[model samples]
Target chain A: LAKTTQPISMDSYEGQEVNITCSHNNIATNDYITWYQQFPSQGPRFIIQGYKTKVTNEVASLFIPADRKSSTLSLPRVSLSDTAVYYCLVVGMDTGRRALTFGSGTRLQVQP
Target chain B: EAGVAQSPRYKIIEKRQSVAFWCNPISGHATLYWYQQILGQGPKLLIQFQNNGVVDDSQLPKDRFSAERLKGVDSTLKIQPAKLEDSAVYLCASSSRDRAQNIQYFGAGTRLSVL
Candidate 1:
């Protein structure tokens, strides 16, 4: 399984573009990179997913380099409501091909 | 288009006690997933069901945890002789069968506190 590493927390101001980067040095070719946002007491919500290059959506943009070792999740003009934990996930089937292994996520704090 | 529904939003039990959580996926989705979210961590997948069949359950702790999806619509996750380490939020999510764009829809989740 490919594990992800990210900063424990980040502090940003509202209206600023916040970028959270995740490193998966051992990412497999068949794996997919995904980002999820989670609010307090709520299940994590999908934000964006990508194989490589740049993929933009209504909520965020995902940038994956050619090396595929790391990916960046960009939230444009973030607001206080965006203050939550952001998780970077490498989706790959386990040996038995059942569940997704989640790692420790990055907590984003948007200050006014 | 009702979203995924999970019952008993909260549960508290002592070690050695048993508990069960229920989930009803989206109206037409064929895939359902159960995940465990510990505080300060991302949700870990416990099991996956493709319709009424089990797709994956390697991460589930079989010693005390078990889950089943009957009729391919509603599902249940049970923990027998719960342990303090079992304290976490249990989330139910669903996705369509398409290979591309497998976006998962999640419920509010059931928070369990094992004493």
Candidate 2:
């Protein structure tokens, strides 16, 4: 498994765009970058995933460079409810296994 | 579809006591995972099961924690002689191998407080 590095915390105001970057210098050929959002007293929810380039969903957008060394998660027009801890993970797709390693995610505080 | 289900949403016990948590994965999900989340930290994988067989338990404290999945549907994680450091949230997640995506659906989790 490749290790990931992200900010410990970030502060954003409502209606602003927030971008969280994650670094995975040792990312492998089959590794994919995924992000998850966790709220207080709730389980972590999948936010977005990308192999390379850009991937957008209804909730967020993931941008990955050609080197795949790093990726960015962009949340547009943030709301106070979007305040939560966001996790960045690098998982291998070569095997059918489904175990994930999580780090001390980036805590995003959305202010009103 | 219903998400993963976990029982005993909250548990409090004294050190040296035993406690157990149950989890029911989403329908047709062949892979199940158990994780421990300490305060101010991210969730750590404790065990992973594929069907009725164990896939991985490298991070599990086998000396005191044990888990079993019956008939490849439900699972139970037990901790005997719990310690104060055992206080944390136990999370259960599941995903289907049939899907190419590795998305996992997580349960609310069981909060354990060992005093």
Cα-based lDDT for every prediction: 0.87, 0.87
Residue-wise lDDT of candidate 1 within B11-111, one digit each (tens)? 99999999999999999999999999888777888988999998878789999999999999999999998999999999999999723247788899999
**Residue B10, model 1: Cα distance from true site in angstroms:** 0.4
CAPRI quality level assigned to candidate 1 from its DockQ score? medium
- Candidate 1, residue A78: Cα displacement in angstroms equals 1.2
| Candidate 2 Cα misplacement greater than 4 A, ranges | A92-99, B98-100
**Residue by residue across A77-106, what tens digits does model 2's lDDT show?**
999999999988675322444445575699
Per-residue lDDT of candidate 1, residues A2-98 (tens digit): 4668999999999999999998776666767888888887877899999999999999999999998899999999999999999876764445342
Q: List the DockQ of the predictions in order.
A: 0.62, 0.59
DockQ of 2: 0.59
Q: Give the interface RMSD of each candidate.
A: 2.2, 2.3
Pairs that collide, model 2:
none
Q: Candidate 1 — what's its lDDT?
A: 0.87
RMSD values for the candidates in order, in angstroms, are: 1.9, 2.7
